[model samples]
Target: MATTTGTEAPELTGLPLLGSLFDLKNDSLGTFLRARRDHGDVVRISAGPPGIRTTVYGVFSAAGAQQVLAGESANFRKDNAFYQEVRESFGNGLLTSQDEDYLRQRRLVQPLFTRRRVDGYAAAVAAETTTLIEEWRDAGAGTVDVLQAMTRLSLRAVARILFGTDVDAAVEIVEDNFPDVGAYVLRRGYSPLNVPRDWPTPGNRRAATVHRALYEVCDRIIAERRSSGGAPGDGQDLLTLLVEAESAEDGSFDATELREQVLVFLLAGHETTATSLGFALHLLALHPEERKRAHEEVDRVLAGRTPGAGDLDALPYVTRVLKEAMRLFPAAPVIGRRAVEATVVGGVAIPAGADVIVAPWVTHRHPDYWEDAERFDPDRFTPEAEAARPRYAWFPFGGGPRACIGQHFSMLESVIALAMILQRHDLEAVDTVVPVAPAITLQAAGPARCRLTPRRP
Candidate 1:
């Protein structure tokens, strides 16, 4: 057994054998919030039964978040079972790669995500948003499921940008299959013991089917692109960039690796932005005053013209609305890692090889840092107020060297889509409360239903 150092975190009391397993699997967001409120910054949580039990250190304070995700990030590696499952399912893409593989991947992928480069995708984002606006308008005054609608819009935008003319080949495969894949990853990832995946269990069989379809479509698309000898149209799509992205020493991605990278982009690029946009729209619908402020900002900045990337800075209030929505419902609510060695976070000792989780959901609402934390207040993100908070106080995108490479892209898509929506329609909350479930991402468990009234005369 490894020797420990410093003060140990308090253990969260749980049911006899299952510990916090059921609570965590069912209501993770609420569980993390209550754990933070009851146990303070660092809490030791055990799940499962007997010999197979797993203990995870929940780091929920802003200071603890900064330390775990940034300050002592090197001491905390992405070697946990959850990451292992994600790596196995998704391949060693940017989200799951570690050490040398991660470094190489980051180096090759970083150039494509620069602000200027991501800004180039804004036109694609706006076009997609316009398509959605037209669809809603055409549907008349009927209520729309915000989550479902945003998910399609975001997936289509990313697929179009990634595949160009090959977009049709990839969209349905990714959009239809990712949910099943995510559910499989979660179930197997959290289980302390699992029957061998080759045994053909019901879950395993379904997962295999979904994985095959997803991989086959991506492989077909890549093959066609390679054989075609040129990219679609002007060759500005992300897939073209990936095909051409090469370093003298590192070289370029092979067909299989290209599929992995594409899978990662589709998963991270669309879903996270969808979660933010859906929640932002829902929050606005519920809060009329804030929605009004957003409307005024969008109307003033856009002036009845389609918004472009250049207008990003011109709509500060709209940006704040998006920021606040992310604060409340971060896409990746709970991030898991393993302590590489014994470490102290927020005065709590973490054992070597301990499973650790930093929850942005709880950290963002820390009573010590946020006033009236549950309130939907976009002003909380103003320059002065943000500067007053801890660095990790609001990390919808994970922090440290592994911080989301798609940060700029997600923001750009979100800002453009959100601003455009507010410009075209006035939203009313048809579903007063949106119940959320924290999975691979924060999911709206119930419909985020809203009634859209066209703003045009």
Candidate 2:
């Protein structure tokens, strides 16, 4: 097996406990980027304990990433240490599962998120965004946090399309529980022995309660759908598909598996889209000229009406802005895999059992790959511009066999959301500071306060 001998391994010099502890508590992407810049793309660090080596692979090139994701994937497995913490909240959902279980779950859930099915939800996305915009207008922008607003709008859209019923109440349940679950999963030294739910620790208790509440919500939704007898005529929501989906072997997902899948879509699908939209809006507000270009594109194609799925192709500029926003702050910023066996990535030997971190945050901003990597230039994603670049250099939804199943869903949702919003009101950033926070998803550190004004004729 390929191995990095003591002499061949990247030099490691940081104080083990201090660096590891600080990295665990602070921005992981920032820490990893700094090390990569200082020590080159392939850097090894001792993460606080013996035998626990962290390998950050700088995938600045498409070929390098393909090597890890496609060429030598068999040697890599989902990082169980990281995912075990997530399993506490997400269970063995597709996002956290590994091996055969993961493959099975992904196969069963893939059909529901197929491009054809996801496209059908465009109307729902536009309607939801329109409703929220009208409400925001009626309220007369004192100071609205667009992040929270987008979260609500995106959640409602997911609810309408995924469940076929407006489950706004359940959306509220999810919003409340999501942060605590994310915090619990991200905490360092996380283990079953650390703290029990009954302990006095606020975080522990909150985690337990949130987990219970999430299950209850999922149970209610499942029971309601089952009683309703599949989809109502003409109802093409995701839950309808899930209720009817059959496996290749003539089996269907059991209640437990169904619950997990539903929860996964409910959480992963909506949250990431909302975060991307929030960031897009913020960027549009900051760059008035770019925002004007987007508005002009929307005005021409949409012609002052709501956008449908067909409008997606015509609104290329709007889509570019969203793509660039995700490139800058990918919702799933960093993805890692533990080497099940020794492997070679980009011609570099990766030892067995090493954690291989592939950070889109670093890759997206790599000076070697993108021109003006730090700037917000949506034009970079235009057809002509995109062709000039390598494929794997930009993977907000990841790639390979495990690429995000809901990518088309997100793109459709963002296109509709952006087009609908631009058609109505023009937004401006408030003086308030918008911090960048990396949670289960990268979100505006705090509320994203913005000023909204109705566009004049």
Candidate 3:
């Protein structure tokens, strides 16, 4: 490990407990950005009862993130406190599991998320988006929560693509479970052990019950699919693939593992993508010029037709809007890791067992790395401009071996959904400041109110 030649350990100047807890409860990115500005790129944060130290690095530069994510194994481990929280809900699924178990599950599940298989779901995505847009069109000039709509649309897409059935009955169950699971996983102040399921406390019982119900739903889906011989014939749904995948050493996922994988995809895949789409639409609504540009692109490529897998490459501006939105409010904003052994990050010595946090929300908007970092500029993600950025600078899906396996699927779904919606309707944001809150994924605090008007012919 490289040692810093400086005389004293760098200390962040603030009310450590209050600031840290406030950030934990509220907007973590804002807190981190303010702290980073005040206390340089690498400052020790003293938070929690145990006084854990966190190193917040700039998102514009990828060196520190690369070191922790893709560097040698001796330096880092996926053993963060948050991972324990995720395991509470997702069990040993790919998102939380580490080492060999993670590798095995990822390998088995990876083949299902291959480019070819994901592309196959494009038609289903467009169809679902069309259904959603039809409903929005019927309710013209009325206040609608685009965030909630996106959540429903994306959840339905995941359901249809993963299970090969509409399964609209499970939608309410999954939607109710989301906030509870999110609070339980992302918020650290809450304790799973102490809080009883029947407790009157705000999110404790709700989280517990929702988690059980979600697992039950997954269990039922798996059993139904397996007994039915994997969704008829020639189906490319994820459940079908899971029931059929084989491992060289351990064989295919057992019932429990299958259940966990389903839960992970249901929660991680849909919710994050929905949140990103919601934010993208919100950004476009706020910026009419960009909205007009996106509408023009949608009209040109899609030509009033619903977008399919083939239309994705042609909708570059729409892709840029989604990219910029994710840059500002990344679905999985802050990724955490624990140092398994002493290591050096950006010339600073990090002791073993230290907590490391890499925030794409912060990094993507770093002033040093981006021009007018705070402003919403989709052009920054254009082909020519994006080529100039560092490889790891703008990783909303993350990077390295443990990166999100469903990135391509999520991106494709977002583009198709956005294009379909744009084809039929124009969205305008209500003149209100919607706060972004983190609960496993970033979401609008209240409903993201917008008015949808049918597009003129």
Instruction: Give the top-scoring candidate (TM-score).
Output: 1
TM-scores for candidates 1 onward, in order: 0.98, 0.92, 0.91
For each candidate, what is the lDDT?
Answer: 0.88, 0.75, 0.77
Q: Note the residue pairs that clash in candidate 1.
A: none
Instruction: Encode model 1's per-residue lDDT on 1-457: one tens digit a residue.
Output: 3335679799888999889989888887888888888899999998888888999999998878888888888888989888888888899999988888888888888888888898999989998899889888776846899889999999999998898877767887887899999998888888888887788888999999999999999888888778876577898888888888899977888998899999999999899999999999999999999999999888877889999999999999989999999999899999998998898887889988899999988988998889999999999989999999888889999998889999889989999999999988899999988888876888888999998888851
Query: After aligning candidate 1 to the native by TM-score, how far in Å is the CA of 446 from where it should be?
Result: 0.5
Clashes of each: 0, 1, 1
lDDT of 2 by residue, 209-255 (tens): 88899888877777777788775567577776887778765367777
User: Per-residue lDDT tens digits of candidate 3, residues 376-399?
Assistant: 999999888888887767888877
Candidates 1 and 3 compared: the better one by lDDT is: 1
What's the ranking of the predictions by TM-score, best on top?
Answer: 1, 2, 3
State residue 457's C-alpha deviation in candidate 3, in Å. Answer: 5.9
State the local distance difference test value for candidate 3: 0.77
Lowest lDDT 10-residue stretch of candidate 2: 188-197
Model 1 bad stretches (over 4 Å): 1-4
Error of 3 at 273 (Å): 0.8
| lDDT for predicted candidate 2 compared with the true structure | 0.75
Report clash pairs, candidate 3.
Answer: 59-363
